[model samples]
Target: MDSYTSAAVDGHLLTPVTRKPPLRSSADRHGPISKLGDDLLVAILIRLPNARSAFLCKSVCKRWSSLISTSAAVSFITVNRAGSTTAANNLL
Candidate 1:
């Protein structure tokens, strides 16, 4: 049979532990969002509620800014380059 006892000091009880848990690395703490590709990032940013929200996402990092700017340009060109002149005029 094995037995152990806890020591009490100042009305608090303390127990002995065999080992402490390992500390997490900075990358592990931040998770995998940084690992997403530019295409996926652009798709996510496009789903933001409005232009202001999308612009806010741009300030998150330099990479995000580049992706957001590129996606916005592509979207603008696509909208303005349509065959229908009425659709282009209505945008203005």
Candidate 2:
């Protein structure tokens, strides 16, 4: 298995690679989720087993705190996405 891949491999001696973590973008360094819009975030949060679990995720950061605080925004969209009477009711 001889190939010119990462510069970290220098003749079989496994050198420690000191590479920075992959960034979502140069402007936003928070994380991949931080880059998502409110609707998208709500979609993801709604899948957290139950509302309490989803609500607790607000402690993760200010953006989440603000978003989760707005229950109408998250609930309204979550209901629509559920698209079933029982599923929508379960969201409550």
- Which is the leading candidate under TM-score? 2
TM per candidate: 0.45, 0.50
Candidate 1: 10-residue stretch with minimal lDDT: 76-85
Where does candidate 2 stray beyond 4 Å?
Answer: 1-27, 74-92
Report how far off residue 14 is in candidate 1 (Å). Answer: 37
Model 1 Cα RMSD, 1 decimal: 9.4
lDDT digits (tens) for residues 1-92 of candidate 2: 35445655645654455898786663276756667776666666765665677667879888788888886855754554433344444544
Q: Model 2: number of clashes?
A: 0
User: How much lDDT does candidate 1 score?
Assistant: 0.58
lDDT of 1 by residue, 9-31 (tens): 55766666688779887557557
Highest lDDT against the true fold, candidate:
2
Error of 1 at 46 (Å): 1.3
